[model samples]
Target: MPGALPYWRLSGFYFCYFALLGATAPFLALYFDYLEFSPARIGELIAITMLMRCVAPNVWGWLGDYTGRRLAIVRFGAVCTLISFAGIFISKSYAWLALVMALHAFFWHAVLPQFEVITLAHLREQAAKYSQIRLWGSIGFIVAVVGLGQLFEHLSLAAYPLAIVLIMAAICISSFWVPDAQPRHRPEFAGQGRFIEQLKRPQILGFYLSVSLMQLSNGPYYTFLSVHLEALGYARGAIGGFWALGVLAEIVLFMFMAQLLARFSLRRVLLASFLITAVRWVLLGNLADHVVVLIIAQLMHAATFGSFHAASIHFVQRSFGDRQQGQGQALYAALAGVGGALGALYSGYSWSTLGSSWTFTLASVAVLAGAAVIATCLKEERP
Candidate 1:
């Protein structure tokens, strides 16, 4: 199409990637509950899945950058994910489920960072269109969460595997139609730069560390927020609504994000996001009972996730340019992957033993630390 990518051409793939996440994030705990798995067992299963992202994304990134064949790696990863997810359907045991979870996550996580590189490539000078493209994925998430919430209330938990399989199949089919554009390497950004050199840049290191801590803080939300909300007498529909609200806010943020960034420096945006995250978690910890406060906290997803993510990607694109895009994207995924894994594991333990308030309070502290690092290290000048 003229300026917009034909949704028929690209939206389906984004839909598949995010739709799988929607199913897993909101309902995985409930799925574990149905299998009679204990809280700890569920935590461990989810932690292992996050752990796989740490290694898999980097591995896939390396292969893609080295071969200059990003799409091939994505296609392979998707097929592997499908095969592994099938293993979950065949077995009901915790051991089998854990293996399935880890295996599928390894492959599933590999696809996204590469897809990000692909999206950036396609965006060219019109990166502002990212939200319009990405919003469809948010729509997919809303559809999965709302539709499946009602479905699960009536249907048995046995439907989980079938739902997952069908969504994954959609992803695979969509992958076939995704346009793969190769980024032209820019020597200025590439020459004499080892990965370690890139890592050693003060702004780069600071940005990575700051985002790592912020994501670490998010561990509790990704792992236990749904369970916590459910415990507070929020029905599945309400919880789904709450989750949908956050994404809706995120969609709004994405829509205005280009203008926001043009008006604000990246460091300023990152700084604000970190501070808002600190407040959002603290509120989520102490004020979830107050509907008004909860809605406000949910709205902060715009700053905490959508703004921060756009700023990070913008920083990467500005800093690394075309030549190092793959590696830059991989490094972001690596830090986030590792941080998220540890955060999920720790949050699982803390949520069960220390309780939600203390867990989220600690999460708030983590974000504050990230904010401090960014304030000190991320700079106005690109290296």
Candidate 2:
């Protein structure tokens, strides 16, 4: 399989990973809703998962980097994820659910940044092919979300956790088949700077702040957009369709992102993503009642998420060089993880008390603040 097309092989793994998320992301809250978990309990559960994202990846990345054993770490993590997720099958109470989400997320989040290290190692010569590789994740997400959406329309929501377990098993199996690739060491920066100094550079700082804000704004959408849509009378299938549409737009953007990055500065691409995100959120908050407007807002996800993420990864590669790749990716995961966790926790409170519109409006405000910080403080020096 290593001789297979790179995109198909790499993306097949991601398809499994995110297919698991697609099953969980769209309907986990809804399942909890069925179980009559209080809004606060639901928020805590999701927030804890994101919180684990904040803590686990750093420790795991450091281990991978220190030992130079990234693939081994990834495989170990997959095994742990498979075992930990089974915890959910036996327990349904809020406290038990929190423990399960925390454990699974610790291992699940541990794998991606390291996988990213491996992906970049393989694609160093033809980085433009990232979208071709990554688009399968969108495809996987669509399959799981759409398939399970219809399933839930007819079957019991109790089956949702099992759906995630099955998909994760596929992820672990695919992961085992993924070829092990190690990043080439950069001799030029072999001993150049401290991790703190690399982090303080203008362009890197700006990109991190910008994306942290972007993911922060996504808090409300990831946490409650489905609930909000359901409240507005959007059927489950239509809601999944809307979610899938955002990723489809993401697929289109990924198709051409390599060219876009080659032609434009990462700073420019990053800035455009931030502006569009601000627009997307505000539109979602105020115009969600209008289907056409909402669809337009969703389409902007191509730029808001796809372009932003591609550019952010590029900036990290440029900013940190080979030596700090682990740290760079970990920092991205950390800041975004903490921000996303806060966003989910806060939005849960906001969603329950203040309402969805106000909650999303606040998220847009966070984006605006992030954009301002990037504009004022982030300076890009040509390499």
Candidate 3:
């Protein structure tokens, strides 16, 4: 490890950032349902937030790359995100909530991709150790999901926005403690041409497409799993427990990710993650009524999110030059947002019309398609 690594500060930022996600992902849809929103309306509300990801990251990435002020951008975005999200407390109407979701998500989406660039810049030569720091995010997620689940069980779902706002405040405070680091430009990849040309390459395009599909498959899980579990007679606390179980599995994967990356090629890791994710969706859709089966499915999150995400980050770092790092990470986030929006929309419609089992079946099909793309288009490359 580098002597100068701001390890705790970097990890602290991830912890707080994802802790917000922990609060949001499991309960946001549930909160909407609590307010008597229809499944489609809930999906639309979530999609609005996701749709911002399609635009915000690119706009912020360009500014960060151009100004070489990635950390400053992260700080600004963090503050804006907190301010914008606080608008949720203003109204419960669909239109009003939709506006708030879009407003907050634009800035919220901007923070992570630029922060990713900052974290990687800080890591420098110890890039494979990225998972070591990122695992704190999983821990944060676990804490938020489990703790909030228990809390919400006792209190009202009305408190959801307030809990998230407090976590966002922590995110805002943490961003300031981390100092900035610029990416070291590598000339060897300069011949690959500009960012546009690099993106046009077959492998890069395939990798991104797979990323979108993976997120798309995750749509049903993120947008409605709590609702689905609730309808199946699980309590709010158990729903949170299930969500925490998935992140617990993710945290375990992160702990070993450096060793896994050293031993396995990124393509292999991704392919395996996709394949296992397909199975996971199948299990989630079909056997969620069975506690043991559900446990197995949740554990598969280690592959579905943890391994897939770590590999994707490493891929962007290797494929783009320092000059393009911000854009590269932004594009990754943008594509993910694209996939997530589609996932949320489709799952919302399908959940009510097709039923939970069929909706998850569709998610599995999406993951299978992503796996096929990986197998056919991506070549083996060690991280």
Candidate topping TM-score: 3
- Rank order by lDDT, top first? 3, 1, 2
TM-score for candidate 1, residues paired by index: 0.95
- The candidate, 1 or 2, that scores higher on lDDT is 1
Clashes of each: 0, 0, 0
Q: State in Å the error of residue 64, model 1.
A: 0.6
Residue 90, model 2: lDDT of 88
Model 1 regions lying over 4 Å from their true place: 1-8, 381-383
32-138: candidate 3 lDDT, tens digit per residue: 99999999999999999889999999999989989999999999999999999898888889899998999999999999999999999988999989999999999
User: Poorest 10 consecutive residues of model 3 by lDDT?
Assistant: 374-383
C-alpha lDDT score of every prediction, in listed order:
0.83, 0.81, 0.94
For residues 43-100, what per-residue lDDT tens digits would candidate 1 score against the true structure? 7888888788778878888788888888888888888899899998678898888899
Better of 2 and 3 by lDDT: 3
lDDT of 2: 0.81
Per-residue lDDT of 136-163 in model 2, one digit per residue for the tens? 8888988988898888788888888788
Evaluated at residue 200, the lDDT of candidate 3 is 85
Q: If scored against the real structure, what TM-score would every candidate get?
A: 0.95, 0.95, 0.99
